[model samples]
Target: MNKKITIYSENPFYDKSLKTRHMKATIFKMVTLSSLLFSLGFLIFFLSDIVIKGLPAFQQTYIQVDVTYNEKTVKSTRKAVNKEYRRLVSRSWLRTIPQQVIDNPNLMNTKIKLWILADDQVDQYLKGHHHNLKPKYIQSVDNLVKNNATKLRFNIIFFTRGDSKIPEYAGIKSAVIGSILTLIVTMVVAFPIAVMTAIYLEEFAADNLWTQFIEININNLAAIPSILFGLLGLAVFINLFGLPRSSPLVGGLTLAIMTLPIIIISSRAALRSVPDNIRQAGYGLGLTKIQVVKDHVFPLAFPGVMTGSIIGLAQAMGETAPLIIIGMVAFIPDSPNSIMQAATVMPAQIFTWAGMPERAYVEKTAAGIMVLLTILISLNAMAIYLRKKFEVKW
Candidate 1:
């Protein structure tokens, strides 16, 4: 029986418009949630990778033995050994290890190998400490040898030691002095020049063709490749000015030039961010142009300027190509005593170490990288703190 069924469009309150709106809202929320999750995932992955790669450098290997001054053994084994010394010495103590293990026989079957510590550490111990390194009771094992044997205290002495042919012995001495000296040079030179230029352009300079040209140049300079500045430093500072090649002074000057554009741009932006009403108020109060800009404009821009300077320094700190072009020595024969002496920055040191044939050097390079990353992170933290401290919300 084909009965005519009443197919009413408004049988129920089925508002297609409201239904469509609800569907759109659901889609919008899903899209937003998806975007947020994707962003978080990328960030987590990146941070995890960096931490994993960088954390190993801070860990070192060591073996601690309850080293007693076996005077008879010391006298017999170490020719001309000092008797008055009462400090736990290095690998010279190892001579006792073989005999001790031999006499005990229990240790002979144990898995503890004696040659875990590097030979140089052994030499240092025999020489006696310039300072006392005596711990109350050492469990007795060698420190910092090839392959992952045992984890030991992270040695801060890595920072104090001189350059070594052995990668294990190489520490911050290779590039710390050089990198620091370069930063100092950059700060000393860059800050004044950038501040002055910013002031002139923003305050005194006419809004004309020349000013436009200068602005263009500054922007272009900021965009220029860092290696080009290294080339420029090589050509001008090293060649024309007869500055020593690969000297910290040269590296600093090159970095300063590279950093200037950023400083100028940031300073300008900071200056512009200041309220025009403040400038007008200063004018109304009969302040000179210099006084108004210096007292008001500069103070407002200080935080931004600092932020830019720090970022620039961080960039320069990690630059290797430019320093390489300028003949920065990856291996400095001695610790640099002056800016004129040849030097390698931390990045250069890292580059050199990463290219090392030995696997141990890979760890050393990673350690060096960890150190570098610490410095950068600390600098960035300081910048953020400064910005927060001085930020004036409108």
Candidate 2:
């Protein structure tokens, strides 16, 4: 009878195991949220700083002038200065500014400075045997003065012009061209070589002592000082091969050396992510090793490989030390016409401009950093998108 009356109690914190699990889950979520907030805060701060410091690169101020070119006022008939060509041409820019200001009165008070055109092109036009300064072709003279003339100003033109010191006239055309060329050169030389090396090591090479040594060596290459590569480039490309100093080709070569290890390691990792079961299955199906890797392994690895290459490119894009050693930091006035042509990359340009005595250069450097970072982020985004797009499902 006593055993039949068993008492059962329900605890208020019922199911202690559930309570403990809930507490742990709550802690994990809090930690994860806190970490995410901290990371996002840091990123926002960095981006805000870059934008604030670089905003000046967009705004520009110049000195506007009215130029007059009368063919009747031809002073000399010499080959250099005859037919009112030289003066008329010089006067051309000056004439255009006044008309611009007249057409847009808001520009009247805007400071304008005439840009220094190479070859004294205005002089040539003034000296040429032109009948008269065409009324339709009134010369406009707007000289670039201080780059920091307007607050919160954005100058798309300055970003487009190449590196130059032609007073207010210099454009970023050269720097833009050089950046594009540098990227192209990097992709061309680095992409295929990286893919091939990765394939050989992952799919072809035997896992023996020699291969182990090679792997060790490749890893070591990643740790080599970038400056050492620069020194190597200086000696090999400049001193030994007699390549031109400051050429994009030299920059590309140095960057390739710097990037190769990254690409190799990344590609190998990608290839290894392929499950061994997949390979075994391919073999059971009577597929060759090459076919197994080509059809199954390579596809899975491509995403990771592309991501790694993009990361390497991002690093290369921001590299300045190696380029400094190779003389790529020099100011280039015109856009590069060929790979052999000398050029300045955005990072190099930013470095050089940051050291300039003018405050304007500081803003420009900040702007350049922003641009460089933007491109890197874009590349990363592309890699992420590609990863999601091509990721294999099990």
Candidate 3:
């Protein structure tokens, strides 16, 4: 009998497959990192543009006018400013001079110098932006600046007042208040229902054709165009239900419909992330499925659910299309005192400003964008913090 010797050798096919997979993985990682960098770069460019356009809104150009509050000038406040410089002063300020004199009658035909806001033209020029200002108006502004009469002041009106045809009088306060009311309604209506739906889908519902169909439709709804939700709101909320158009209640209801899918999808994902072994362990302890999910699964998933809900709310806060469809874009200068009253939201306010013919609106729109961006960033940051605090690693 011949002695048989067997030699063990590395499997060439397996070695080749291993090397190929390593190369593909390296390529995929490079591609993913490059894409991330490209996205971050684009975001930086966008934010930089918004900041450049918005910074000018925080400071306003003012010109000192030597007002001769005579009976004639008081009657027609246009005479308070020099004939050449009248066009360089804010018309809103010109209209208020007569009222100022009526309130404070201490000066009759007095030479009281007052620092009043300059025109949009002068404001543009002061900020080195191109304008259609005449040579004479430019000279007047230059002379005032040379005499230390024209200066930049911190704008307080932008916060305290409401939207105005005149950019100088336009403010975000009304929109801010309206947004608060609308979001309050949205949170109240959407949060609990979304949580319940997630709980049902994840725990109690039987896995059947109907459940599969519902799941598919929900995923589809999440991908639907937001504008379609707006149209739906216009049709259902405004037409069928006859809810007060432009009211925060209507706007919130519209947004709530739009937001529901997102919260449901996110909450379901959170519930699904709990390990099967955890549920098995709960059953091992004689706990029912309801108790297992409610006690064991939910506590672990709460952070994720909370994070998703906040993210969805933040998205709703920045939405404008649905509100516009529901007539929430109405020029509301006063803040709504109740959800039932007609209101305007911050995003709608920004959209309205962005469409104005006035150059001042460029800055106002940019400033509004900045504020919106800040709110979104803060919300995202909070979500991240909550996720970090409660996230479980298994």
| lDDT leader | 3
Clashes of each: 8, 50, 0
Candidate 3 similarity to native, TM-score:
0.87
Cα lDDT, model 1, residue 127: 28
List residue ranges in candidate 2 displaced over 4 A: 1-42, 62-67, 70-154, 166-170
Model-by-model lDDT, in order?
Answer: 0.70, 0.69, 0.88
TM-score of every prediction relative to native:
0.71, 0.69, 0.87
Give the residue spans of candidate 3 off by over 4 A. Answer: 1-36, 107-109, 276-296
lDDT of 1 by residue, 235-290 (tens): 99989999998899999999999989988987887777788888889999999998
Clashing pairs in 3: none
Q: In order, what is each prediction's RMSD in angstroms?
A: 10.2, 11.7, 6.3
Q: What are the per-residue Cα lDDT tens digits for candidate 2 across 193-263?
A: 98889899988899999999989998998998889899999999899999889989988988998899999
Better of 1 and 2 by lDDT: 1
Best by TM-score: 3
In Å, residue 344's CA in model 3 sits off its true spot by: 1.6
